[model samples]
Target: MASGKHRDNIKQQSKAAAKKSGNSIASRISNSFRNHQQVAVDSLDRLLASISGTLMIWIMIAIAMALPLFLLLFLQNLQQFGSDLDEASQISVFMNTTTEMPRLEQLRDELLGRSEIQNVEIISAETALQEFQASSGFGDILSGLDENPLPPVLLVTPLAQDAAVLQPLLASLQDYPEVDEVQFDLDWLQRLYGILNLAQRLTYMIGLLLALGVALVVGNTIKLAIENRRDEIVVVKLVGGTDAYVSRPFLYTGLWYGAGGGLIACVLILLAQLILQGPVSRLAGLYEGEFALVGLGISGFFMVLLLSAMLGWFGAWLSVLRHLRAIEPG
Candidate 1:
């Protein structure tokens, strides 16, 4: 009976000890989180205390971030405009002046039936002459001609914009007896594509350089901050504070700077878009284009904020690791 009682007592003690251990672990985790939270809040308060200096840093970072962002937005809009032009691209097939209306209609139908062609629009000789007269502002001279000078034309929209496909199609059209000339102006289209590609490359290069600039700016700011708080860091270390504990506030400070800069950059970009909207609309109107300026939507906005915060954190981390090691309590 005594042996059984002793076994029961041992089991109860083990259960109690396990419970106490679990509670201790939970308490430690809670304390760690609370400490981090307090540190982060305190860091932000310090930044707020010197609003002028903080604002200056934020503006510098924002300008650096905004330059690349603006270039990217411009490139996106330009690409969209280029796509619009690409979709409207067509081959002009001028028929022989002697070609009859019936032959022109038949040729258009045949071109439309081809797998490579998406659409074919026929402009009768008389209609072409009238359009030319209206556009050229030489209506009197054109009307005095005994016979219509313009030939019937077919505007052929191809299914594919690839040069390989378009070149063959152009050659085939030229072989047709009714075709006086097949003009696709492939060179201009190719040049447009080349220009867009070059622009994209330039944007990427500029974005990379600007991103580096942002990181450097943050790092330099953090370095200055470390210098200002040199005595505080040395005191903390002397009191047996861990490196992480000493560095937590600075890390948070960097994060605040980056996040603030990101926010300011967003504002700048929006303002720029608004300022340019009217001019862009008017210009597009002049070109008979229905293009509208696009801004960083919700996803892009959040992404910028996140990226800026990351850069700030990285800069702070680098600064802390480099400078904290050199400071000794002795």
Candidate 2:
């Protein structure tokens, strides 16, 4: 019985050993994954702490980047508004309601002769007043007016996309003996065009300057990271760690800086848009336009994220290459 018990004990010991070995291997693999993930986060923390004024630098860059980016997106909506105006050449002419029908008929015939004219519709004062009443939310009040009072209006549409025709047409119409007034609210369109042009140019300039800020911030951050890990790096190189191995943590550091800054930029832009959206939409509503504030589309968001990550990665890589050689203990 004693010998049988001993044999049983031996068998039990063998099974326990196998389980222990299996657990050890599994634990090692789990630990490796944990270490890999932790390394990146830890490196970022260490790097961030090492860099003096890094937080301030990143915030500054993000704010600068968001400004023009916001303006650019806002102007994109304006461009869409112009698209709605495509079909209507948007020419307005005013004539005295007392003008003879024959003269108005002759004016129409002359307009039809112009090759540059596509479609023309004339609205009489009565029809114009009715339209105004319906849209003004004062339909009941408008009926109490003494008379329609509005003058006869001619609305013109051009055949060509070129808006320059309005100038020549306006000159001719002003000279017409029967014409009282020729008007095109070209001021709004022209002002919008000027603003859009300025936004585009400013966008580029802001982008360049902000990008330089990003590069400088990242570079300085990586430099500080190198200085912080001087002792650890020296020991790492002394212990047969490859250059690649030593560089990994610093590279991750820069990536985190850039990525963090980019994320902040995204949030800032979105927040700013949100804050301004209500007022902007209310103003547009007053003008009879359904102006919905649009944000940075998916592609643009991704590109910005990519640019930020690249900036950080390149900055870290540069720091590692430049400083790591000096960190080796001969």
- lDDT top scorer: 1
lDDT by residue for model 2 (1-330), tens: 999999999888966865877756677679667866887988767756856666775676577667667767777877777656654546788888776556666778789789877766778777889899889888887798887767878787766544476667778878876678887775567566667778888888877777777777777767876898788888988887778778888787777778777777888877877898999889988989777777876787877777887887887777777877778686
**Clash totals in order:** 0, 0
Q: TM-score, each model?
A: 0.69, 0.58
Give the alpha carbon lDDT tens digit for every residue of 190-292 in model 1.
6776786788889889878877777778788888889999999999999878899988988898898999999999999999999999999999999998989
Runs off by more than 4 Å, candidate 1: 1-23, 91-183
What are the runs in model 2 whose C-alpha is more than 4 Å off?
Answer: 1-38, 45-58, 84-87, 90-191
Residue 294 accuracy (lDDT) in model 2: 76
The lDDT values for all models are: 0.88, 0.75
